[model samples]
Target: MFSEPEEPTATRMRRARATACAALKVEDAAQNPIWGYAGRTLSGLVHGSEEDGWLRVVSETAARAGGRLWEGPRTASFALPASVPRPALHRIHDWTEEGWSYRAELYAYAPASVVSPGPVLDTDLDLSEAWWAGLGTALDALAAVPTDRVSMREEYIRRAVAEFTGHAVGGIPWSTAHGDLHWANLTGPELLILDWEGWGRAPYGFDAALLHIYALRAPETANHVRKTLAHFLDDPAVRVAELTVCAQVLQAADRTPFYAALADPVRRYLKRMGRGAV
Candidate 1:
């Protein structure tokens, strides 16, 4: 269908990206291609004579890997409300070459710059008052937009909450969420949430909760996020969102050294909440 040669993975990813750009008829403007977890996706910038956009390429070794879900972000621009602060999708190219499937999306340029391109935020961000206000507005507007897309399965949420929070949950207050609200997916000075592959309905306050969890290592900033999104704090749904995010991070910890720091903070958080995860 499309590309990994490592086992040739990195090389295959790059070649796949180049071929995608050529097929899409865009010029590569980035010095380097940004890679996703384990190099499953590769992304860079592309430009024509007068226009520029971010070009992202994704590969799957199997026909059913992520299936239809991976197309959410690629098509999100056409459906999400204008109030949502995100780039507009310009074009998409999908094809099968050499037994691999590749899908490339070119989106209107993202302005300002990314806050952090990693899952964890170690530095304290001195975000502006306007930026904080904008984040709140964006989250609120996003929540109001209705969608049938499922970010996390109902059964998965029940099981994860029970496993991590040590309690059974019912009647979750659902709202649209970016699903992945880590520092890596956010931009600042101005607020622009990126990478919306999993945007869909989730428990209330999910975005705020996930954002807080990622900032836990930077205590001051984490506190700032909670304070900024205070309306979302103290809700039962938010608490569930928090612990569930903790479970996700803990799972990531075992695989990547960078995420290992998040596990202790999660345990401390659980203890504070009077719950213990076995």
Candidate 2:
């Protein structure tokens, strides 16, 4: 004979309550449900399914990191300013169990945008020229301000140059930067840029160089990026050199996994940067 044990519905509800009670400071724990579509990340994407509406659970690790980065309450206390268009943080909570404790945040989920499935390099959108001009404008504005007045640190500048100087010929002009700008991080129409974790001022061409090097996979496209940049920046050879260095540094850091996934031409650019081949 065989026997199995099953909890009654009331017992199951109690268990669920205990779990929620341990995790959150509940003003109320009503069954408020929500749904989420799958979103992509550097690691991979979690797909949405019909069986369960997407649960926006913030784990302890994420709560801790957010607290460290934002220097505030871990959960349910505050929200980022509305001026920012990235994902919204709904609430934060702490969960405790035997010998373990963790923090987490609940987030309002937005449907994933319908993104083009082509390689970043081959996208025919070809705003290389516009992007180039925008970058130049941004750089010129940044450079007009004295470095001492800006928040940029000398060490950061040096590291930027050192990271890419091998491939580029000379120094680029210094300026403030968005730090990270890529197609994936951008939203259409609104041009809302997210993930401000690393935002700061840096050299003038740093963002453009990063985008060109990482997104333009084909040599022809890369050449186009270079031409656009040169034209927009008025063919400033010194600036180009500096930008190349910055690009190399970005490629090396490989923060976005897309850069790591690139094939030979991309790798070659990085290698050239290391050797100052440009």
Candidate 3:
């Protein structure tokens, strides 16, 4: 039972109309179709603009970098670059009445080829261990890429480590990280990682730490994850230190609403580690 804010009806209609107009401009099939307003969070509301024969409109507040923050529209445009996930970008407009909006080029929403059991919030220590093991494999795959090839911000990485490690205790390991790796951002049975807005290179353990800390709110689950992660690495101490830094940076960012659910011990641990770097 989450208490989510309701988007106004007039605003919904405006968004729907905008999606419809954008669809027509793109020469997508179907003129009039049912529109639905999806979930709203601290970031912004998700609206399914129009679902006709061939296309659908999915729009929301554009998320920011450095952290998982949402800022209003920076600029308006009809076509977005290939870097954007969608096929075509219809129109980008700023509305004083309705924040920034963009209509993605229409695409069919396909059902997942395989669907796992719905997310189980309570701890399944065994399952968590397996998940962590899989996560490690993913991280290793990500890390194999040469650092120079990836578009990682050196300043950001420097600041992150400097903020977390007062003195250079030891050199930090480098790798590309998802930046924010959480369940909600992931979609489909294929688990194709979506929401690449916060993606960039970071220290090796950042993604693992973020995922572990988020999952470890439950003591049993946290311990299980830690154990799983331990099996993957050569140096447990360094992994712990990296995880500490990730927890602190994540806590400071205040990205997830579920932060409130984190346990006091974990919170205290993060605060202690964060103080060392900041």
Candidate 4:
């Protein structure tokens, strides 16, 4: 079978940075440097620009839920109010410079990420119960606010779960979620969620479910998440959320090593859920 060649990282980074600089009106800024690079997007601190901020440049075709979550691609983010503890957005711009199109979002820079970006985090957090306490705090804060954003409904979950296990789950609760909740998008030494492009209303326990799914690689961490979010996860709706996320990672196992590692545990989980033993 033939596969398309992946674009070289250096080439992608330079193009992304160039688009970011142009859109941010800081094309000549000399202090700019790459802070992080996920597959289709790159973020860095901007300098010599009229405004001080962190810039995130992403490919246009990338699946971004921010548009619906924040009310469109050109609009500023106001849905996440002060209590959420996320970076404040400064501006947003979308355009096709050269042949490829892009969307650039500038935000106030955050100090650091809790763990390096990837499927698994190996850092010894030496975290206290207070750190775990923040998860519940953040989720409660998010749930208190209502939004017109799109819902991450159970039908989607049912389809995804059915794709793998030939079973469907229904009637899950819905609420706003940090759609891409995972260690990579979180910063610590202090808790700050990064990468808002996917924030929107999702299944009620979706964020914690995704986080726990990722933590399955570390049983202790997974247990910690389960215990902390037990208030919500105890709801049957939330169990469906966990199963939905597991189905997703299991379905995407070929693309990343992280998902590959999740296979067995997810399979075990599905089996239990299927038997109504969860």
Candidate 5:
């Protein structure tokens, strides 16, 4: 171990982080660690510099082993374009400790900071044309690949789109997506995508629509997103993708007040498309 491994605690985030650090042969970064959303799965992440001078990100995720969530990141790490501008996975350590399956992943630290602390983009970003080009290229490349998993179930897509829009959809264009795409999972100044734990196939333009939904509160940013990913967002075939994401946000809003703000905007958007009777 490069550092003394802390005792594993099933409930505490730091314990998992420390254990992962030790297993990955890394120490804590200069700054504090970041935690993901509070959920049934307990997880935490921190970054540090490796002996090789490359920045290393160590994260511990608690979930059932042999499932999609358990395998997504490791699968994406090897499957994605390594030459692209994103963190490169170097090593991984997974084991069952304290009656829970814990996965620790070590990735080359992303080159730029995340655009937003939360899923919603609350502020404007002065992204360059080159940045937009890079993002388009990356997303395009990602969409071209095939995958075994799926981000959204075909049955769910059909139900949600029909229930939300009062219109049925056929031949929904399916493609690979980052799945949980939002400003929080993207970097500023550069376009390095993060958190690949949910990557899988979905409706074409799903990623862009998700990001755009998050940016609705920030009109300038929202418009900028539309302008940038217009190729995906503007196509008539992408209506199902847009409706699918909006329905998801509406459903989430119903469950928690945190997502409430996005619900009305999505409703209006659906209504404008001659749908949204529901």
Candidate 6:
């Protein structure tokens, strides 16, 4: 029995990318790019003019939520300095000039994220102990950026509490957080945090709590995160943050397979901590 020849993966990717680009109406979009795709939209990271900076084409809804999404698929650029370790929204472009209605927005790209060794849930990252110190420094730097982005609010916490634990959430210490601090959003080797759209004030330990929960599949890594960021996780407000993130994870398990392994442990954690036992 003879088998049909297979299409080269590169060729397949190129074809798919071409289709996506054509759909987005970005004729200038790079062929091979780092894609942040969700549902029907595509956020492709591509190079830009040295003076203008990089470009990122994202879904219209997502772009509107962060930048100027209501401005009719327009482009908005940030004046952020290059020294910052964030891919802050630089500029956004609407497809209206091209008379296209694909419901996508283009953005000026930020500094590329570091090449990760592996997924955060795969295993303990082989980072140096000194790198942990640097991680603290980087987090501190991120915290210093004054932003109004509110990743989680009291109502969100209350809903999660009522739906999952049925316990009232207490006072939470608020601080600037990188709302989505997962392995995929984080870049390593050089330790750069990606995706700043979620940067904003949140419960004190919210970021660390989320990170620890994601690391649960690998207990050793989870333990390491707890130990390293103990100052944040050890706070009294951590109870609220932990429940909040766990509830959020449980909710997410229904939608994405990424949080499948986390669903059970998160429930157990909520039961333990939700009763104010922790």
Q: State which candidate has the highest lDDT.
A: 1
What are the runs in model 1 whose C-alpha is more than 4 Å off? 1-7, 65-68, 276-278
Q: Give the per-residue lDDT of model 3 (tens digit) for 55-121.
A: 3333455442212222211110121222222222233333222453444333334333211121113
Best by the TM-score measure: 1
Q: How well is each residue in 1-278 modelled by candidate 6, as lDDT tens digits? A: 01222444334334444544455444544444554433223345543344333344333332233442233223112422243345445344344222223233444454545434232385666666765666566665555556565667778888876686666765666776767777776655555565555566777777788888888777887888888888878778677777778777777788766666678877777656637423
User: What TM-scores do the predictions have?
Assistant: 0.91, 0.44, 0.51, 0.81, 0.85, 0.70
- TM-score-wise, the better of 3 and 6 is 6
Error of 6 at 239 (Å): 1.7
Local accuracy of candidate 5 as per-residue lDDT tens digits, 113-160? 777777876677788888878877888888887799877899998897
Q: Tens digits of per-residue lDDT for model 2 on 177-242?
A: 444555455543333333333444455565556556655565665566566666433344345434
lDDT, candidate 6, residue 52? 30
| Comparing 4 and 5 on TM-score, the stronger one | 5
Stronger candidate by lDDT (2 vs 5): 5
Question: Global lDDT of each model?
Answer: 0.79, 0.41, 0.42, 0.67, 0.71, 0.57
**How would you order the candidates by TM-score, starting with the best?**
1, 5, 4, 6, 3, 2
Worst 10 residues of 6 by lDDT: 72-81
Ranking by lDDT: 1, 5, 4, 6, 3, 2
Off by over 4 Å in 2: 1-122, 126-172, 218-257, 260-278
Clash count per candidate: 9, 13, 2, 2, 0, 12
User: What is candidate 5's TM-score against the reference?
Assistant: 0.85
Least accurate stretch of 10 residues (summed lDDT) in model 1? 1-10
Local lDDT at 71 for model 5: 77
